[model samples]
Target: MPLFTPEKAQTTDQAKQNCVFMNTKDYDDMVAKCQIKPLYVQLNGVVFLAKPLAECPKDKIMLNANQRKHARISLLSNIQVEPYAPQHSDYTDLVQFAIVPRKALPFDSMNSDLLQKEAISQLIHRTVYDQPLTLEFEQQFFDVTAKSQTLQIVTNTTFFKFSVPHPASKNLQLTGDHVESAVVKDSQLMRFVKQTQESMKQKSDGQEQPTDDDNFELDIEFLGVGGCNKQFADIFRRAFVPRLLPPQIVKQYQMQMVRGLVLYGPPGTGKTLIARKIGEILNAKEPKLVSGPEILNAYVGKSEENIRNLFADAEKEYEEKGDDSELHLIIMDELDAICKQRGSRNDSTGTGDSIVNQLLAKMDGVKQINNVLVIGMTNRLDLMDEALLRPGRFEIQVEIHLPDKVGREQIFRIHTKRFVAKNAFDPEISIEELAELTPNYSGAEIQGVVNAALSYAQTRMMNAQAALEGQQVSLKEFRLLKKDFIRALKEVKAGFGKCDDKQIQLIQQMGFLNSAGTTPIIQDIQNYIQTIRNSSIKLGTVLLHSNSSGTGKSSIAAEIAKTCGIEFVKFISAEALVLKAATEMERCNAIVKAFQDAYKVPEALIILDGIEDIIMYTSEGMRFSNQILTTMLPLLKRGQGRLIVIGTTSKFYGMQALDVTKCFYKQIHVDGLDKTLIDEIVQEWCESRNIKWEGGKASELQCIIDREIVTIRALLQSLEQAASGCNEVQCSDFGKFFENTW
Candidate 1:
């Protein structure tokens, strides 16, 4: 039962006289209104003894049933009080004349806790008064603390001032200033910052600040963490600073920070670097960074013990200090090795199951340790146990995906800054050009490109040194030329198995990226391909459908297979299959042979281009046997791990008549290029051709839509004519090209 005395509506004086409960905050206020003595009050129709204490005791209420510092009074009551507890007692108590509805709400009488789906959202208007007794009288402490009277916050090195509004007023004035340090000294603000710093200190056990590893600042180039400031801001501030915030303020706002976070993504995208930097910023005490192999033992129970030992230090501190425990961060790299889905283990040892259970128990099990943070990094999120990823465990998941064009530019600037600063770099080597060249490169891969260029410069010096055997090599003339970077581009190959620029943007426009919440399309496609390869099911069909020709369906099918890292992708059309055949019978045999040949490869995307033509389809009043249709249907169903048939067709009505729509498992509609993609094509084409496209972007898009469904090929052809030895092509030129071509 709720420990409250429900009361009916009465006068303010009567309400005060009858009220039986109060909190620590309202202890003095309640004392001013009433006498401190043993009294009897009605609780759930039963009478109980209650009293107000002379002092707050043991940080706990002495009148309540349990040894708790605070009581959770229901928000349904309009009145509130802060109850005082005697210092020797362990229980903290506050009794309230809870507003009992004349008719009970449907939510009442269900249970001690409400249902999950139903939540109470109410607007609370509160009043505030300051306690002059709590204020410090010393002037020196006041002088040092005056800076934070106008509160300021920082993000991306820019400071913005903020002020607390009083209950009666809506506005609060503030003054801004530059932030020369992350340190704060004001008494109230220091309560938050100092806690955050100490929590960070727990990772390293308050180790002395290290000497500079290099004279150049990491912020100057942001090495190992290039191009990630914007994305990092949200995760860093939320995870780091919020925990540093005043606990009462945080509770008043109904917000929480998860101690467990996972950073999972592709290889070399800098998940570990981000985790290390975070640990550094938090100043964690002996921050543990372990790879999966380090903990996995051959012995069954030993593996689980290793997992326990990882948290022993932090758990011990939590037990000793309770809420005052320091922050502990454990970064587990390649987490899928041990945390595989609980029952997914095939071994007789059952070690995987034990390891997963041990990790989960440490995270949110019965003990409820709050100071430890587990940061798990993995390339395979799918292979991990489902229970561990849910809320209260590793709930904060962020994907460290490959860099985009702009991100790539920022990365390039960082990687090449050293050479540029020393004036040993080529002026013609544009950072933008290099960024554009490597669309899906990871941070490590981009760093490799810089290494490759340095390697070339070394080779040039070696060759020069060989020419003059006796004299010292001319270090003065050693410089990186534009050709050296061009050479490195060929030798390094930062991005190998990725989609072309156009294909990537096209996929993005098709809402593939919008569907991706934490994983990028690259990972999604790889996972899908792996499923198709490993699953017991035999067949899957992907259809690329468009209403008109030149939709680049064949190109897209091959690109999809390529981006999926499939090496053998075959394109089959009537011309390639039937040119050598002497008769219709021979042509059918050849087509069947090509399909059979495709099945030989371990995972091939066989693109059957011009699907209607492949089926002896004709529109000029000609009829054909349904033998081809029958043979293809069963063949599609029988396809196993080796073959994935992707068929393309401009005509959907023809497929309906043939009754072969069911053969295709997934049909992706290939449509006209959206404006964003159109812009990329136009700008790149004009740039290469040394021609200017003066046509307004909106006008061109509208004009194309106004005319007809514009294929990328047709758009390029039109652009070609407009840029045929012209200084600039205007919107009017597009009209001429559209009219003349279409």
Candidate 2:
């Protein structure tokens, strides 16, 4: 039995008087009687004739045709014409027929009318072998009728009640080779047959609906641990501690989850990398990495819509999977770009604040979106809205700072180990020394230095490869060429040089020291030098303040000697004062002995270079023990004739604490040149090398100053490289200098 019900007559009176039969031929008359025009004529509940049933004049038909004969044949065959009605009893094997009129129909019944007509047409063509079938109908004019017995007929122009066989009893089992199995099975095909239906009743009463999976999970891994300090890592680890528990325990405990974390730092300090690493460490199942720019939209209100969509989509994904354990990590890089402070009326209105507001609302609306963690990275945390950083939002603020000496050395080792394995150089060249020398170098700078060294080595190897048929870089070649590698390390010019001459002169003039004879002199000198050096004067003592560098101290002292118009003499320990050659007094006498020789010279400047090696600071931070001070006091206080004893100490503070300040009339600090001086030196160097400074070359000189305000020696070397093998000092040539210096 079919589920479809068709209009049917209940009584004999209604069946005989109201029911009307229609064929393709009588469709027009039937439609006319009902004050409608037939659009399609049906047979066996399927449309057999769908052409317009109106009559057309021969002339009108011929006007549109290539030949009048063709037009006349189509007009007569395709159009429906009147036919005799069939009796209800004669329609015992009646096929259902649907009649569609050429007028607007109600929205609800229009689809059914079209589908019935189509199904009837298919049945006639396939099962009925294109044979026409008689259709009988009983029409009722009453407004009301019984719900089950009522037969409602809807046409394009009017509503009428029709009596026909019950739709279930009239079900035609479609047959024939022309029937498509796919069409019979297709729901859409069934809809075309006026059998469209949807199940409204619940499958099982009182059965609970299955809940959607609302949980998200994520697995994050930190590769190449980002440049986060141990403290920061600890904080991050603590924040995600709960996530490390077993699933069952985690569910039972209801851990206080960390929702958001922010990484703040200067540009190029690896905030983004740290954020990424933290995300990896958290090990969320679905971590969404989004750049701040992704949230912006071109149209007004569209950015807010996008933000909403992003969260909505994430929730939808969790829901669809029906998994509560899924973790969602939203990593926002350059967050300051999209979460700026709200603008005042005077400021341009559109900005990150609007987007920030949307994010804030979403974040606050949910108490425990357990699996979702928001990590934001910003170089300019100050520019972000305060609301974004408040207690519940990005509460965990981690700072990513420039690497310190130990960190830099670790970074350098990581970067250069490959190069070291390939090239032959002293592996013992002191990374500690390198770290000390690279004062303010960031991790990126350390990498650059290593890369520059490798490049230099490659260039040398390339030249050598051309000369020698196929020779690996030999130890000798690496030693000779590895000067470039050392040069690369020197490029970052850590401004850890000695104090300058002006500072030394100022300390002397300040009368911080009192001259006395023997023991009194050494003690007074030590006190004066220490006081002046450690004072809060804008400039400290002018003594060379470099670390343990023998060559640097010697060169600087010799230069000062020459500048001061004094005979510079190196005082070897053997020629100076001595007690027992092995005793502590002997070491003190050795220093005093050197000073005595310089004091004997009327105006000689003695260079006590590498003083820390000769004299050690006592535990009191004073340079030289009391016993050594006793031996040196006499020579220092003697003040031989007009001699200006210029003792250069690399460790000036250590020397001061030794109470050796009274010996030298003036102390001169020799530090690295300022940018202005460096620039002047570079200009002079370019001129001396005959390198033309064309194309606003002064600016290029200034850039070098800006990049690395190095020592006079470093600046000179850089300038030489900038001018090397070129008549004109082009800006491009500066790269070699920077490569060598950085």
Candidate 3:
């Protein structure tokens, strides 16, 4: 039997008010041909609406055209989006768009010169008008074509950013027979659809806040399953740890079971894995994995019906089993697809809003089903609906952050255990050293690193077999070497290494002894930052200058920006950009674009790393464009917006020309660490390395610094070597470190 009564479209006026007007300019008969359902009609002076096929008076909802002539769709429900009845759809799960892209919209460029960038943006904006819509979902139905020009777009997330590579037309048409779009199953289409939404949201938001999935802490009890410790901590510990306790005890204390648990982190950080484990560990009964489009229907009312149907089984089981009911686990992967922040998209057709309303009602519904548990996972945590993350909803929100050094070590051991057990991996494999090298590698990335090394070893064996031709290659003799691991480490880079409080504290402590010199350097910069914050100083660029060898002026500048409580810090390393962008124009554009991005965030700190490179100062001649310098002066001046620009320069005088030097509020000199500061650094390094630093050792370290050290970088290196060697810097070690130094 049908769960609920479907509403009908009453009149043309009602249609104008509720339904999207089908303005078929090219095809007039298309509207008539379309299946507009819940169609109301007056048959022989009686107004009537047809019921669902499950609970209907007749077999067909629509009668002959002669009788249907007066039948107008009072409400457009039961509309068959597919040419045929959707075979893949589940009544309990609601609408499932299982279509795959046989053909896609050309996003390369617009037909002619008349197409503006805004026009293309408008096209995309228009395309995403209905539902919690995604590009791929829309792409399945329509083809975005220009008048004459060739266009292309890239959906290159993970490897590259999804961006509009070329301009598109203003009146770009969307017309196609969307019948043959199904290439894969329902779950895949929904994944592609939601992923498209993520890309679209990112493109629209302007600010690209990077997702962090570096390292994860794994449960010690689950060594074979070790790597995602933080994931387990955030999920199982908070949500299910209490479930393990005696039911009577939990009830006596009025212990509340979490209604919903959300595991939000970067991609490949084991959010989904955590959810799957919850189901496995608890042995949840009939655990439902609802992708975004599971409840979304093309027809009105049908989608809502689908939402109701999803909970029907759980509701029935709860009533039958009462308090002794088994847990009904609902794992909603990519929660952002259906439950994004309310009213985020202005052009929303209320379908997403209705879905959220249904979910909210079900979660906090009148008839309490304590047995049901909803676990949501998403890469885009910020985009999820606020109400969904409220106290009664997904109350326990834990961040699955990147693991530290120790966490990485655990991850390494787990990933390499298979080979270790088989003796195919050498015992001499330095897991600690490998962990250190893979600083910001995610759990998945760490697995990749191990797999990469294994691949190399396999390749080596294969090569040997091929070269020998007749000789039998020994598989047991071929083991993973240090070089293979090193090669993998070199390939994978630590992503998004932001400057935080630790970096700031490191700079804060490492200062000269005297109050007059470098000790006051941090204080001076602090004062400038305060001035900018209070709006007392004419907000502009501040230069950190140093003639001292390896003085770390750039490091100080970054630390200053971080310490100043600035949310938006755009660290523009001129050297990083200038090297990549060969032309002077390209270099300027890169810098200017970064500067513009900084302006997007109010009270932003733009750190100009290696200022000399931007100015093209080599003490001989300046080859950089004068236009760039002029453009930079006003931007550096902080003429508008709460902006603070901090730049570092080894040669301060070289910036005297190009009018850039005059822009700085003050030039603070960064001096090398004094003897006291050196000792403090050495002590920390020794403790971190598990080396004793007391009595004779301290004196030896001080002597080495006082005699040979010129910078904190050099001091740390010398101390590290000394601690490893004999817990004290030998006089011979000092001579070897600085053979030619005064």
Candidate 4:
């Protein structure tokens, strides 16, 4: 008889306890009619344990809210009071299985293990299906679901999976075969459970286990690496770690394992360190650390043979273990040394091409091995062969960029942790300040800074001992000071923070431009620089031109480059061009090389001082080297890397005639100082240097600015000449000095 009802069950506490009550007579009839005593009621295709309720109506069955929700029914439902029997004859005393909560629970508030054990205890001596089981935790009962299959619990059950929601459900998409072995201790399920429990215990005990989001149970230790948490996360997600699931699970899901990844970035940014650390952290066999140059040989076929030998063990392991093999790691540094774009190699020997072919065959050839993970590190990712960068080869590429301020702080703390723990580091040294000071510093460079600081402290210790003359001195007294770190900054140069000190000195020497006459022009140039910084375009060019010579155009250019905060400030002056190269082609080549070098770094500023002189511009025949002019135009417009070019020239009309003015993003004409501006500059300069300057002969100084195109350069040179001979620079001395100089 149909006995289930669609009506909501009564609110009695007893009905809420995962129990469905049935009428006494109907239950007795069903039990008697069945060949075996009825133990479960099958309602709406779901089975539940049957319990008799004397008060229930004879025509109806009672179900709790949980039962109705699991059943997914609304109206009147029919039920069969059926008996359960084991289908498999070799039923063991114990079964291993995994369970997932049908809904989210506060695992943090409850004893997770106790809840799992309680759920296991309830299924003892009962027939279990691959369906929901009501389990109690902290006096609250909930349904725990498993894979959509059946399992018969004969005597006892052990949970092989628990919370944080298994990765297989999301990452690998587990099938029935993943949980099919409902055997005793020797089953794959039991092995997996044991490994998970061990891993969880290690994590709970405050050990640094491999990142758990991807759920590959391995021990990873990046002892000295810092500022690369995101990169490591990507490696785990897109590389070999995600494929660390059991052989059966992987086979059932038909997922391909990640075999190769490329880690490329600026030198000293920890690409090689990350690769080496990954090799150390994985549970794979010892990694083969071969540099790109190591594969090259003079003999024919030898380089290819060397490449094959690197994969020899992995191939053999795959042959023996098939899909059940342990992982093999191969880390290759300087990968661009051999993998330059195919057919671009200039060598006649063709050794580089053979090495690349051998690597491709080993990584993704016919009958490829599934157990090897190749990690290639290079700073020049653009030089790698395109074929090796596609999917199923070195498919995953992660750029290990230089650490930011926060990452720099982390690297500093990591490097100085032992010193801090030993109380040898200064208590007042603000690490945040150091991080701010060391902009664009790589992890290795940060380590170098720490080492340099230590060297300073050691030097102080030796000096103290030398002064004591064989007297005992406490080692703790030789702690690193704030000044030591400050001094160390000068000693260690970061790869990205490579600035020229001569440019800074020149800017300092050109301090006269801070007067009222030049402030607006300086501010305008600063605005242009800010626009370049905010825009998506990588290249920006500005031209500072004047109608007359000695207008301090080069000084203004140097000041702009120095104060803008770009670490790489290069001055490509005509003197440098002439001194470095004699011929016009050689000079053009030098100019091209300067821009190319700037592209290697993330940001740079190139000051083309005296642009007319560099191009050999002359009034005679309107002649300038067309070769240099052509090279300079494209380089100024080249949109690669974060580059800002400031070109200075006195011959504005000549540049315009040659069409070179169009290459600049902005053009500002610099004007010479007028009479009133010259008076203000002279007064400030005298007060700054403590020289007496009363404008008793101010009218004579006016003649200095009275010329048709008198530049700031001419006025400053006159003042310098007057100051060279006397204790005070008076306005009267300017006329006599100009008479002698001109």
Candidate 5:
């Protein structure tokens, strides 16, 4: 069943002669005689026919019958065969001789066609000088040629052609000449290849021109124009610009535009929020929000390495992909943790300085790597390295200050918009007035006020649940809620409640004038005491130009009785009037009371000591409040009793508005402390108590205090909160207090 085998073979010369004759029958006959079934036959280096063993010719005659059968069997079973070797001239038909049983092929039997062709090829090589033979098949003819002793083989459908190497003598001079010629040709070809390669490279480099789409610039608007807020925003925006560009191209441009930005301010001023908003506005492609702690590394150089890798990776991404829109914004909040002031010897220089130097170099390095923006946020800007702030570096500095009246109003409206939209108020109160009352209120404080008001309303509704209170929050409820909201705010002391130089000056001015007025003694005392307390003096004086109703005198006296630091109290009435007995005895007792009060509390003064009553004749006749003249006459004398005092007036013009006689110590015409001062007092008071100053700022403080001139009782109530731990005073506190008093 095998197509070919070693047992059935032919002499190479005989096979070659047969192939030259182009006799298919003879070839088949010869193969049959040899009992060789040629599955594939190669002639003159060309394959003529290749078929399976079973498909090969089966007509070759063999003896059959008794003796003939025995001979045929002997021929089939014991035919003598020998390995074929071709003479040099036999190469002409080498292709035919190479075909044998597929199994007998020297190469792998599985690929007999390929092996036959290889054998023919080798015979051709060995006999290159031998003339090539032409074989004419049914459709075509083959021609084989040999040149320079190298085999040139060609095959057609009908014929195969071959050329073989010719033998030549070796000559040193000639060989050298050929070698030199070959080298020169090779050198010329290599130069052309190199030139072509360089040209292609140049074209590729040119195609990568930087585009605007790869670069981005952001403009962030911040709080104060002249303050750190704007500077910081600008610096941050610049830092982000280079990050938007292709790093490689951007580097080529050598424009180091992008750098880190840092913002710092008071705690509640919204520093972090503003930074986040900036990121949003810039619309970073890939924003990395990191805290200061994230950059810290335990290993000496690891942190710096990590930082370098972070930026490097970003740049590499842009360079490799050529995506211009890719942006990596690294926002480092609390930047002070790692980038602390540089010169501290105790700090870890290797770790800290490495990070600092690396960050510094990356931010504004001369190399101009684009596509990375670093933003640093901190509450402690003072603690950062100065190099980080240099022009090419962070460059921009922004500071957010406490909101002013207008800003407070805007903030209040922003926070309360939801409530207002729900029809919480029938007629909205003047926001300007609210803003005025909330002095030193930050954005957080305004928001807290709105929240407090809403919370108060909710609480009230819950308490009235059984009454079937409507879901709607009414104007009345809102007002009441607002009042309670304000009152609660007075308990926080952290904001602007602490007395500063301006506040102290205002208190001193108010306390001076209240003691000089002379009207009905009781009324004068009331006016003076109210003015001093409303000024938020905390420690000061009250002088009353009054007599009679020492009950009213004692009432004012009792208001600041619990003042912890320093407070003075004195009552002037009929008993002292009698002791003096002068026509101006009542006024003299009023002055004496002021002196005694000052003596009692050298640091503070309360002047309502002893005075019964005073009567005065007015321009309209009919004995008008003479209490004013009687009180002023003694106060004008200026004796040992010259400090500060509170005065009241039941009747105006009952005494001169001013005592040119220099009678009373210092005259602080008692009217009312301004809206700003009132707001500050409440804020200060609440802050001391550790209460949150939610809404109701300085202006609001003033509005509530001024709504109805602050009375001695109101002052006592406001001050009483100081004992309850509500340190910071807010406008809302005074508003609630006033509402309750009403």
Candidate 6:
């Protein structure tokens, strides 16, 4: 057909409907010639499904302002309209689109579903991408942007994802069939709509909108809690949303609603915080918060009555609305306090067991209520009853573990956001560095670190004010420097991965240091520490042995424990156990307790110093304690959390005979000093300590080094005694010392 000049219609229903005006003669001629069904016209490299305007004059084709603007053509430009026949792959029934207003739209002023109905009614069967079609509603223009995949030929299944304005959409979600869902495989346009919808929802909930640069995937973020995006998503998907499904669909599908969830992890890992925010995020009824101890009453039957009271509101709601009631959230902190195993203890009154029975009845009884959601938080999951954790009860268990490096960094940001916003932090304060500095800090500990840093800053400000005379201190000048964080690190120690300074100090006082390149054995021990740290294998054991005593085997084991960088390190010394416990059974009990404590931490290093002493080894008939060995063997080899057990012993051959060597993953032999090493160490010690040594005169020292092995500990002790008060020493003086010592 010959091209006709496009004209903009200022006031016409055809213009608002994105239709092209054509004269009666031209429309009849084109329809008869092409016989195109669901007529489509292409202009200016863009395609649009066109509608005929019957009120137009003959020989003229009309272009509304929206159609002309969408094609980027002017009124004076003549355009050739071609019928669009889409290929097989170029069609899509559903198009997820977005509506961007010229300004922010107020809540309740527009309906998202109605706007979608109008846009889809006009632009269906049109291939559109990047070009936006304007729809006027309530004297406001909303730009409807859709991709080519979403805006193709419309079908009966054609559905658009429409997002409502904040606060208004909280109660008025899109009705009937086109609500937000991932039923269609997610596309770029669909992802955009999801992000926009979540953003609006968050704003409606009165939450701080996430910045464009924030990369957290989950929709919920609670104040004073970080690194729990995944856990929150799991709880919402598994426990919260299922209870909100319409009763008819749930009944037809024969699906039981998820009513209970258990959040268990190490203390200070944010389990309680997540439980408290469940009701706030879901916009459900205010959660009935109760501590596990608070549920128990001193009087008989009162505890069971307290348990029944928690479900009273939900029971009433279920009676009124059946399956259509609003969700009722009940969060119980320290759940293990009340939910102990049913027969774990004998109660005279049976009050505790009855409380458990009452809770079970309320959660999953024959007359079940579907409106209630229970979130239980506990530090000790093993103490809870097995029946409570079964599928029909609190089946969803989420472990709120210690945060990783990225998670720790996010937690630091969350805690320090207010300080950062106020510009109270110095330029050198790096959140990433703070995260690295704290390896095993929980969410609560990270918050404590921030508070500690602020305290340091406050102390510095007070000192400055005290030192200056007639000088006013300004709050704006309060800056948190790098030194404040360093000092904060000292104040707030993580309970999990803490270095034992007292044990390290005792080792230093004993004058055993592997820090210098004194021997290749020290380097070998360091490599074992690094291997355990990097390995994915969760459980491992290393044994360090020497044939002789005072060979620094225990010192090397302590060094390994210090450097392993695991969350827990237990130094179980046989000497300390003997001192603390008089009976042999008590000593064995203490040894077992140490291993059990190590299991509670995610990653741990246990140093069994003097393993022979713990097993009560005696050379005279090759006697040892079988009970202690039995207690230590399974604990060393059992695979659970990430654990590395370092065992040091002076009796290598004895351990081999007992088949204890086979239990370890790796074994390294530590050697005493040879003759050549002894000669070098004596000369260096003499020079460093400002003592004079006449080498030729020390015949006894030379004879001992050549004929017998000398350990570092033995040599150092003799040197300290011989050179007690003398600035000058002779080799003949060593012969006098050996005469008395050897």
- In order, the Cα lDDT scores of the candidates are 0.56, 0.46, 0.55, 0.70, 0.44, 0.71
Off by over 4 Å in 6: 1-223, 346-349, 513-518, 528-536, 562-568, 575-603, 616-627, 683-696, 702-709, 723-742
- Please give the ranking of all candidate structures by TM-score, highest first, separated by commas: 6, 4, 1, 3, 2, 5
lDDT of 2: 0.46
Task: Quote model 4's TM-score.
Answer: 0.67
- Judged by TM-score, which candidate is best? 6
**Relative to the unseen true structure, what is the C-alpha lDDT of residue 279 in candidate 1, on a scale of 0 to 100?**
69
lDDT of 4 by residue, 1-742 (tens): 4545544557645453455667888788777776444356666666666667787877677776656777776655554444443344424333434444445544433444454456556654444455455665555555555432334444444443332223323322223222322111123223333444564566578775456454433222224667786777678657643454544565667767778899988788889888877765554577899998898888899889999999998888667645445568889999999898879988798888888888898899997777788999998888899999999999999988888776788788888888889998888999899998997788888889988999989988888988899686797787989999999999897765645676556644635557737667777888888888788879888899988877777777766766787776778888888789999999998998777667766678888988899999997899888888888888887857789899988899989999888988889988876656666777777777777777645567555655566666666667777788566886677776765543
Model 6 poorest 10 in a row by lDDT: 180-189
- How many backbone clashes are present in model 6? 2
Judged by whole-model lDDT over C-alpha atoms, candidate 5 comes out at 0.44
Q: Write the per-residue lDDT of candidate 6 for residues 636-727, one digit (tens) a residue.
A: 77856777888888898999898888889888887777655555666677777878766643355665555465666666666667787988
Give the higher-TM-score candidate: 3 or 6.
6
lDDT of 1: 0.56
Compare candidates 1 and 5 on TM-score and give the better one: 1
Which model is ahead, 1 or 3, in terms of lDDT?
1
TM-score of each: 0.45, 0.37, 0.44, 0.67, 0.36, 0.68
Error of 6 at 634 (Å): 1.9
lDDT of 2 by residue, 298-407 (tens): 78898888777656744664444322234567888888878888773244656456788888886655633554678888867777888878766787888766666666
lDDT of 6: 0.71
Clashing pairs in 6: 21-62, 95-150
